[model samples]
Target: MDFRPLAHFTAQDTWLNDPNGLIVRDGRWHLFFQNNPHGPDWGNMSWGHATSPDLLTWTRHPVAIAHEGPEAIFSGSAVEQDGRVAAVYTSAYADGRQAQSLAWSEDGFTFVKDPANPVLDRGSTGFRDPKVFRYGDSWRMVSVEADERTLLVHASTDLRSWTEVGRFRDEPGTGIWECPDLFPLRLDGEELWVLVLSVQDADGSRVVHRVGSFDGSVFTGGPPRLLDAGQDFYAPATWTGAPAGRRVLLGWMAQPTYAGATPTSPWRGAMTAPRDLSLARVDGSPVVVQKFSPEVTAAFSREVADLPPAALVRCGFDGDASWEFRAGPDVLRLAVEDGSLVVDRRASGLVDFHPQFARVDRLPLPAGTTGFSVLLDRCSVEVLAGPLAVTQLVFPREPFDELRTGGSASARVFAR
Candidate 1:
């Protein structure tokens, strides 16, 4: 198994990163990303574009905005306006400045920088990742405020002038909320849902996710929902019913702790498989499960085998490894030793690790086989463990890992 990055919507490329500006225009889908033209380093941030007609196959286009023009173009949303497609992105120019910049395109590829660049730059701290949407006869934009208390949601009747509407209250636990996005959804048949995410200090152990609902002016709900039960999922963006209709989402996965400071490598980070999203009730309250990409099944079709009756098996990584095991209805656990591995289902739902190179990753499901596969590289890891996939660069303490197998049924591991 060659452990490389995964692309959302489609999977032709192995090293695709963040899913940026996922918008639907003229009955087609446009996806822009935070990309590094040179390779997988974060320093060369640029927007990469892709288009799809059925959300399955994708055609890669040119670098959306070559180098971050005046300010580094971070990420944001796009909407169809006045018969053209418009994009609003967070930019920190080359001269050492940051603000929100907007652009429009007659076609998805060639974007003309709006002459009215920096349309709404209030000399606040710094405005980034502007999520623009159309509601009623007016348009609304929500951005992350310096203070966690206020996730600035602004209103604009026309694309030029803007006014501050209000801020979503910052509650008990919020570190530094980045990338604020909000949209409405219909649940079951009666209720509606609104969701938002604030990327926190990557150096910290986990990321933050919050989902709520709107009643015209503001939004209210319980504490923010944890989008990813795992430690790696972060900086998630949601696109609600493209062209206007179930929301779908894409998330960036990273070892926040490994960013910036690390010497960097052959690859940087990647976006989780695109998920069909919807606000629903789990445990009597509301939670969101990004649906698996339909492409997962296609990959399975071409798979050598399914590890039929996907069992639990102790797996090992010699120098580095690759392969996936279909999960069973039971929970599972995996442990890597000096040169061996162990697989069992009793200790599912929980994850414990050793400080050294030895590592443990437990992808849990309330009722699914603990069976899974592993894709390992000398210094990287891509696990198709439970859900879509989790890819990362791991500086393991040791040079080799031994896999041990346990449990009633055997788990599966495939090697390319």
Candidate 2:
């Protein structure tokens, strides 16, 4: 049940939170993260970097950026500008106000602050976490402006002088849309741009992205589309393609409450699988779907079942177990009872966890109940149940990794 820690990714680490700059340079994939050196809590947020030629084999680099600048250097993006790498970020100052700052890196690892510190700080009290991009002849910035009620878009040609271009309200009538991301997407053969945010409303919090158009000066678009069904996903941002291509994405896995909550490991909070995104045929709508990165599939030590639709198969994976099964509808399910186990799979892709965790006192099933492709990586289980994904942990806290059912138990794969 033990796992070899991912090279750039950690399991024995404390709080590896936000996915910072995710981009491809020189035919290489670069991943930067906001990591807390402290255990499971959001503290000193720094940019930790890693690179990969192929996603499977990751190479960890230095602690790219630390908490030396105004308070903790929050999340931001890096881009190649003027023949050098320049980063734009929301700098958290000690007074609790945010200022947008620029940094330049010639080597892509070491970043030096721009001579014009706080280049565009317009006293947007909570102005932090700046996302900058190049659009045609101008550079654009989408940032959280007011402390709680506003979002702002600015236009600048030199990443220095900034001019307010658009304003959006996220009041209760709307929602507290945290990270405002404005980008372009192709849907059903239509050329369109989308504005997205990490939103919190009366119901709860979710990742929301919307369609909007820029008519020379202003943005006009519909409301956001609630993207993630998982209760745990948040702070998603898009990236420019690698070598040169389409739009990509990166998101932090840590929720506000889950920040620093899990136990310390070689890695703490991890991203959901790195996915290749595109406007595709999703149940008839032009929705975005994640085609699993090859690296995600490469992690499977034992691939038990690759069942087609409505196929069910069970096997006794006695003792300690770790596996990833490509399930179908009814979907795959695995249960544990009094340290024993059960697995249920349905035909249309819904998963039940009650029987799977019966051994753990048969915890009541939460609402929005559905089937899932249970990814059991040691004590970590990621239930990918369509849009609603849930991650759970089970630490044995005993002298064995084996489930305590008369000393052993069994698990199998089933397709309803």
Candidate 3:
């Protein structure tokens, strides 16, 4: 088997996690991530670079910011300012100290570290992952105090000098928080702020989002909710320089328990397809809805199925329904029962790689959920229904050759 994905993005031949510095500059999409350039195991943290004219196709470049001495580059965000692209990331020291630092690239590929590094240091080892963006007349950054489950807000005029302005604490989960992103979206012409971050504890890794209002100094958000209602999908970061009124996102599509033990060679992780995010009102509450980018939607169709080892399967149903992808004796089942979408992968072939890899996931569908779309790759499945999304990595002994649907459902299979 060939396990290379047809749509999702993966490192050419290494390990990568936590998408870093996602931005669009000069009409091209630039994706940077925490990469281990030397091997498939996660270590030697650095920023790996990739560029795309469109999000669906990518070209891998050299490592953007490699580890030097005791400091390894960690997760952060990128922004375009004054005709140059600036990356604000965490400089993690060998002694467990982490602080925010800066690097600049005139061409958006190669970067030079700031001479006066640790641009925003509180002398706290847990403070990191700076996400910077323009607000009003100045730039604002939202980094996390990981161990405390708090988001630290800072203000900067030059993107170099920073000062703490406020902090927000999220206490819903047992895990520490990391990779915090704050942005605004419109719901029915009313602007609402969205905050997204990752929490990791003994159970595993997960991402959560909250919709709220943000003043220049403080952010008051609603209750935290799972960004993706699945066991996988974590450390999601949104693009910075997208066209006006567009918010696109990408996430690390694997969980911590089995991340290092994935059966794939040459590369250890993959990214979910870029998702176009917007706000929809569900029961009078603003909720985030995710859909594939236009480029991805156009590439998948109702026909053209006999090409690669991957496919996009879409379906529509009401009430109770079921769908299955069968490869000989192995079966991956998805069903809607009692208004919840259940994805069962316990017997999805090749499950012995990791005990945690064989499990079932369920997401409560929004009322009146009429349909869903699933992107099926050789080792993963991403399901989007109503306002909920579930991403999981699956290892099938053989590529699925048959798709079965039950109930009053119409199905469309797309592959290129």
Candidate 4:
């Protein structure tokens, strides 16, 4: 079965994992990712570079950071510092030591690693995935200690020297926390910081977020809640340098269970299209809101009346709605019942590969969620309701070519 995505961002001939260094600079959007250039199985990890005028069509560049003597370049964040773009990443040594390192790019395309690499080491076993941002006059960073399920926060005045401020630990869970990101969102005329964390283990990986307050040093928040209720979402990163003050996000759209088991050749993972994030009140509580980026929506000019197998479809409804997609022996159903959004993909196809791939996922929607969008690729479907987004991967026996909707819903399908 062919699994190439039609509208999503993917490396043409390599494996991609976490989205690294998503930033907009110099009138272009820069996307760096965890990539293995030699093959599709995820080794020789390096930072793959790409840029786009808009977020839709991407132009791939050469590998930004190659493997050093005993270390592979891991995930990190990028920022513009003093007329150049700087990338702060983790160097995972062959002997199992991980440390934060730095690289610089005069232009967005070419990058040079700092000679004084591995700038910071906490002397811990699971420290990696550093996300750096500007806070006041200093730069603040958050990296995960996977073994301890904690996030270590650090502050640096020049991005070279650092000091540990505090650590954010979560309740005991089955997985190890990996990517940790902290950013503020304005809601109800108040600013609230959102802590984004990704937990991964043998089972798979899932993203959870906490909404709270963060001073210059410490972050205190409420309990963590599910960010995306799907089996294929992980390692999400947000960028604030977009047009307006939009907090745009992108996530890896593959699960760890079948990371290297997909039928696709040369490439193994792809990223979810960019989503504009906000905070909305649902039942008197603020929830994370995700919608398609305006630039992404504007990229699709030709709109048809019905879904055409693989298309970017915008959907809206007044009351209740239901939709079904089918291709040969595969069928997936989506509906709204009693103010709850349901996705039943039990018979969606290719469930025999993993035990946890076939299941029904549900999300409670607000009272008046009148519109949403579904981005249907060749083998994946990403549905974005108001404050909930569901991403699932399915392998139909044949390509799904039919779509049906009920109630007052209408589908506007767009293809590139």
* Residue range 141-201, candidate 1, lDDT tens digits: 8887644446777788877677877777655554566777777666678556555664565
What TM-score do all the candidates reach, one by one? 0.72, 0.72, 0.97, 0.94
Order the candidates by lDDT, highest first.
Answer: 3, 4, 2, 1
Ranking by TM-score: 3, 4, 1, 2
lDDT for predicted candidate 3 compared with the true structure: 0.88
* Model 2 CA lDDT for position 86: 78
Per-candidate Cα lDDT values, in order, are 0.55, 0.56, 0.88, 0.85
Candidate 4 local distance difference test against the native = 0.85
RMSD of model 2 against the true structure: 8.7
What's the C-alpha lDDT at position 141 in model 1? 85
The residue-by-residue lDDT of candidate 2 on 1-416, one tens digit each, is: 23222212452355676676776777787777777765555678777777777664677777777788456777777777777777787778777777888878887888887878788777656676677877889988888753465667888988889998887764345446577677766766776666767766665566776555765346676655555544456787776555345666656654454444443354567655454455543344444544334455445434344432211222333343322233211222345333333333232122122223222212322233333344443233444333333433332222112221222333444322
For every candidate in turn, the CA RMSD to the true structure comes to 7.7, 8.7, 1.4, 2.0
Instruction: Give me the runs in candidate 3 sitting further than 4 Å from their true place.
Output: 302-308
Give the Å error, residue 55, model 4.
0.5
TM-score of 2: 0.72
Candidate 1 lDDT at 172 equals 55
Error of 3 at 222 (Å): 0.6
